[model samples]
Target: MLLGRLRDPYINYRHRRLFHVLRVSIALTVTFAVVHLFPLEHSSWALVSTVMVMGNLPHIGGVLDKGRQRLLGTLVGAGIGLLLISLPIPGRGVQIGALVAIAIATWLVFSSRQAYAGLMFAISLLLVIGNGAPDFSVALWRSADVLIGTLIGIAATLVILPHKATDVLRFMLADNLDRLARLYHAHTSATSAPGVDTRELLKATSALLVKQRGLVDAVHREGRLSRGEVDELISYQRRMLSTIELLLESHWTTREGHDRINAMQGLRDQQHSLARDLGTLAFQVRTGQPISTDISPFELHSFAELAVGARGTDGRMLFSPSGYLWLNRELARVAASTAQRLASLERLPSKRLRRRAGRHGLHEAQRLDSKEGSQNDPGSH
Candidate 1:
């Protein structure tokens, strides 16, 4: 029973977090051992460098990028320190003034997104100028220590349970898609409980979008995803979110006439079919598999026909048929596009495949939307 109660925390612990902890522990241990064994000056600086470079749960790509930045920063900083030390500025006030100016410049660089280089510059300057007299030799030694620590951190990340940023990106995308599918179903289903909070679903989607930006940054830092791929993925996610918002709006507009609409056999069948397709697509995304069905277009343009044939014509449904058909068509397009995006990511090794996926996905969506629009209202086309 005691063990059973203790299981919750273990069960809740994320694999990513576990691996991150392990990676950091190993890197720090190795860094400490190296500093103690070697005749390196300022061994504590090495430890600090290792900690900074290792970061917390760094992706393989991020580790490499950070290491590179740290090394470059150290070299540049050392050079600057040496230059400053060699300068014949007679007064101590002038030297201090120069140091302060350099510090301000470093801060500006850091704020402008070149954080790694700027940080290194600052460190080098401080190390050389901190004493009563500037010491180029000490600055050089400190730079070497930083470089060594950075290399160790990079090696540990590469060799010890290395986590790929791309994998995290994939998992996050799949999870969000799954949630979106559920939200779509809930909004469209007439039988969904009154307690179902659409607001919460929207909030979750918004949060996922914010998370996606961070994931993209991580992937970029790791050097896994190219600019084109990142842009495509971001565009697809935004379109999907927009489509969901449209679906939610449709649901609210039709809620008052739910019984009458649900009573219609054709409309109900189409909604069910679309919901099933969305769920299947969600599953495919989660599993990193291609969707079996080639979601071609709204094969049935019967919404207008069905509405005209019905006996009792209500104002609530007057503009609703067109709106419903348009919304459904939009949903289908978004789903198909999303599926293609996933397939592209799956076969991401080939640049040609990615290009084709984007081209074909957009073409297919446009064709479907055009066909539906022309069929529903010929003038709009």
Candidate 2:
């Protein structure tokens, strides 16, 4: 039982962060050994460069981006240092004035996208200036050390036990969807289980979204999810959360509304439908399988007809018994879109494989198409 729970995506994903920590630890140890073997002067700079490149990023794509930036910055900085060494500066006063001007110019780094590169340029210049005699070889040597550290850090992450951001994203989404299912279950239980506050869970889900936002760029860099697909996923999640929140905050949460829903057979059926749909969605997301059947409505219009008489004298839903019905319609729309996106995503790999197969594999492609067709047939369900 314990093994099963550990294997579950919702629980297994939390350990991914620890793997990254281990990767950094290994990289740092190797870097120290390299520095000691080389017996390079001012070797602490090498350690700094390694950590700067690998400290936060775990995935290949993210590490690549950081490594590229770090290398670019180191090269640029070293070039500036070499230029300073070759220049005929008059005296210390002029050198201080130039350093002050460079310091002021550093603000551009903060405003620009390639801030790392700019910061490195400044650091390299400062290090060159600090070392007396303006020696060109020393400046170049320091830059080389920095480069060695950067390569080791990046290589350790890419080859040592690489982790993909795509897997992290899939696991995170599965966990969030499961939490959403539980939240919906609790809100629905408000009828019989009053005061089952879901505000915290709702808040928690939003916080999870904040973490997801950072992962999207890494995943996109990895070429797992495209820009359009990211937009669709974002849209579905936002709409889903908003509609669920509206339902929980509406009059249906009160005991009086619960009594009214219990009295109506149709509303009760719709409630069950919503619960079942959410459960199905959670399973589909966790397993990466798509249902072939058309997405079902969260609440039937026939149920809305049954709720027609449940309005205020002013004809406003204003926390009336029918308010939940409209929210259900909105939820149905979100569910359909979410399901459609998942279905299309699941088929993408097969589509790519067949296209790559060419005329030489035409027969095999045909077989695959037929197999896929059978899997996607609505009638099979």
Candidate 3:
């Protein structure tokens, strides 16, 4: 019951919202504290921008990235400022050319994944056009100020309600496990249309990859996940996602092609099932006891048995439409794999098995209660 509530999509969203709000609040407090304490009379605009940028850093990795950008931008802008100040020629042409070069550099960096390069490029340009102080002094002051702000921002981000990337990684893994369960449900229902929707499955798989990237970035920033562990987790996620894609597209081919594809699909489904089970087992290991299985791919056997029983019944059949036996065979392969995953998990300590079974029993009870309520309802008919 508790695990189901934790996994609830609506509950997940609420937690996400609360986390975001907390991060924002911390950033604001840090910005105000810095501004009041330092009281820099001159470059208030620059200070304000730095505060805004620093305050919204959602994760440590992002904070570091912005800091790097600010540093690079300051140096480049400062160098330009010095050169322009030293130049005997005060021509507008020279200034325009310098500005253009800075713009090009910024664009090039921005094209890459370093989002902070644009700011750095702009800062470099600003330093080049200093009003009173020599370009070197202006550049020095600007760089120092930006560095101060960046440090303050990073400090605030790391200190305030500090979160571990590992938690996010676990959350994402849990979500993926849930998605896998849904996919199995879709497969066994016999209602999933003859051809699986490759696009929809791929979209979900792509989102998983995005989350993996986020996990990597978060760990890199906070040192929350070990490098080896991050690599292992990411590699596992990518392999599983690719395998799922292959399976999704396997059903749409010629007869000879179908047979070869079906064999591959069998292996693919088995791998997915094993992976999901391992993930569940890992969670159990982490949480000190095996969580009860609220959802099980193995239970999908009931659906598969129903399909087999419906075979050869005619066009009015309830499951696994023909001309699609190859597809159904592939699905059976997937079910077998799912069963293997559950079995592997069961082989762990008996305590885990008991806990998992206990959860499944609870879910079954709830399901029965729901059915009874529906049957009793006048509107149900």
Q: Best-fitting candidate, measured by TM-score? A: 1
Candidate 1 whole-model C-alpha lDDT, 0 to 1:
0.63
Q: Rank the candidates by lDDT, best first.
A: 2, 1, 3
lDDT of 2 by residue, 1-381 (tens): 554443333333456577678888899999999988987877888898889888788777677767877788778666766666677766674356447646764776777656776777677666765644577667777888888889988888776556766656665665666556556656654243344458777887788777777676666767868757766676677778888888777654345555656566555445545554555565445444544425577545555544665554455443555666677777777777776776777532322223323423434533563453334332333
Model 2: residues with Cα > 4 Å off, grouped in runs: 1-14, 89-113, 131-133, 190-197, 252-264, 288-294, 309-319, 346-381
Clashes of each: 1, 0, 6
Per-residue lDDT over 1-381 for candidate 1, one digit per residue giving the tens place of the 0 to 100 score: 433322221121236677678889898999888988888888788888888988874577667767777787777767766676777767685367547757776767865546877777767666766653666667778878888888888898877766666656655665666566566666655556355577887787678777667666557775657656776776776777787787677653444444445545555445555555655554444333454544545544445565444333354334555555676677778777766655655443423222333322534643563353234331223
- Candidate 1's C-alpha runs over 4 A off are 1-14, 92-112, 193-201, 221-223, 249-260, 263-265, 288-293, 305-317, 346-381
Which number leads on lDDT?
2
Q: What is the TM-score of each candidate against the true structure?
A: 0.75, 0.74, 0.55
Over 45-88, each residue of candidate 3 has an lDDT whose tens digit, in order, gives: 44554565555445556666666666676666666666666677
lDDT of each model, Cα atoms only? 0.63, 0.65, 0.50
TM for candidate 2 is 0.74
The runs of at least 3 residues in candidate 3 whose Cα sits more than 4 Å from the true structure, single-residue gaps closed, are 1-17, 93-97, 100-104, 107-110, 127-143, 185-205, 214-218, 221-381
Clash number for model 1? 1
Pairs of colliding residues, candidate 1: 61-222
